[model samples]
Target: MSLFILWGAVFFTLALVFYSVGIWNDYCHKQLKKWHITMFGLGVLTDTLGTLLMYLHVGYLIFTAHSISGFLGLFLMMSHFCWAFLAIRNNDLQLLNNFHRFSILVWSFWMISYISGLYLGINGLG
Candidate 1:
């Protein structure tokens, strides 16, 4: 694989790790925290970097299932991050406590895209 593709894979894996740790930690604690939000932000940033690197490697966009799901996953992740911030900023106890549910849902969706990308990459189809 090219350097861009290799670096993209590394960043994507980091996104997975950051996102999973954030969501899992928040769920286990049953509360939203600034650290979890930071993780989420890092996840988004790394995922974006990975996507951009992959795009550079590809030289163009292709509307495959992986690409579409990736776009949706990115949107969900951004939304989740913003909601977590808002929940903390507003000091909404209910939202802060229950935000893990939404986080899990978004994480699940994001995982689907992540897994699909991995499949595509491994099969040399991406």
Candidate 2:
């Protein structure tokens, strides 16, 4: 269930990134080019990869790598959210500025909580 939540968040974040960038490009001089798109894809893909890596661990050594990758993925996920919001905010692309801001905050909070929990779990405290 928690894994579902994490993956769900990742998918939602990816969708938001695509939508935000598409909207921005269409509305603001068609600026979101191939490079940005490719980078964004790689970032999200790496994030998902890291999550999967975390999911594969069952012991200390693997768990450590998993923990590190999980945190890295969360960081990348955060970057994606921030980038999407910033692009929209920069262009004043207010499809839902208030909503986006609220969403970003929620995502950030969740990421922090998730990472903290993973930290404790890795340290045998969970």
lDDT of 2 by residue, 1-126 (tens): 356445544653454465345434433554444454454455456456545544543323344543554565456555655665466556654533353344344345435545565566557653
Model 1, 18-65: lDDT tens digits are 999999999988867899989999999999999999999989998888
Off by over 4 Å in 2: 1-43, 58-96
Taking all chains together, each candidate's TM-score versus the true structure is 0.94, 0.34
lDDT of 1 at 77: 96
- Please count the clashing residue pairs in each candidate, in the order shown: 0, 0
RMSD of each: 1.1, 10.9
Best by lDDT: 1
